[model samples]
Target: MTQYPHSPENPMCQHQPVCPSAEATDREAARIIACFPEQGWSLLCNGVIVFEDTGELLPDGSSIAPHRGPARHALAA
Candidate 1:
């Protein structure tokens, strides 16, 4: 089984390394693209849904899930 770089056990958010330390405000104060806390997910500008589980639902209706590894990781490897 493959593991994502920023899984729960790893605890290092690739998008925001300092997410734990940072203060978060509500949508009224912040401009949010989209969020689904219950599903641990959010949508990107181009209609991609990025999940905390390291999965992604692309704008083209394609999926890029975690464990398959991020594109950058594959390229680097």
Candidate 2:
């Protein structure tokens, strides 16, 4: 696993409302510190890499599988 210069308990986010910690359930909501549209992924302030498909790579090297909710079906007339 890769080690980050800052730990989750001591993140170095500068946002008005600091980003969520990598271990938080809503960690994916952290601000995007870096993005690579061509690569379909972005790095969050909390040290997580989120893919366009909703999958994630946490700072500790554990992966969170894509968790997109079920598609909504259209109502029949």
Candidate 3:
């Protein structure tokens, strides 16, 4: 349960928006302001920009990384 500094009390949500605040300076950091329609809350934070749709942050789980098998990326020379 590693928590990011800018994240809110709870990072439990499916849809988190990309921060468009003064704090966010670049597209790399990906700071976002998310609005939880279900829980009725909002959060401001910076994280890995997994997916950005039309400059808006979609749900967190919207872009899940594909699971990798036992294969390794490193090549033994």
Clashing pairs in 3: 14-59, 14-60, 15-59, 18-32, 19-31, 19-32, 19-33
lDDT of each: 0.47, 0.82, 0.37
The candidate that achieves the highest TM-score relative to the unseen native structure: 2
Output the number of the lDDT-best candidate: 2
**Candidate 3 Cα misplacement greater than 4 A, ranges:** 1-28, 32-60, 66-73
Q: Where in model 2 is the C-alpha error above 4 Å? A: 1-10, 71-77
lDDT of 1 by residue, 1-77 (tens): 54436535223333333222112221122223678899798754334456787666654576765644557868988
TM-scores for all predictions: 0.42, 0.75, 0.18
Q: Compute the lDDT of residue 18 as modeled in candidate 3.
A: 32
Which has the higher lDDT value, candidate number 1 or candidate number 3?
A: 1
Instruction: Write the residue-wise lDDT of candidate 3 on 3-65 in tens digits.
Output: 334435233322344343322334333434565556443333443333222233333523334
Clashing pairs in 1: none
Off by over 4 Å in 1: 1-32, 67-77
Angstrom error of the Cα, residue 29, model 2: value is: 1.2
Clashes of 2: 0
Model 2: which residue pairs collide? none
**Per-candidate clashes, comma-separated:** 0, 0, 7
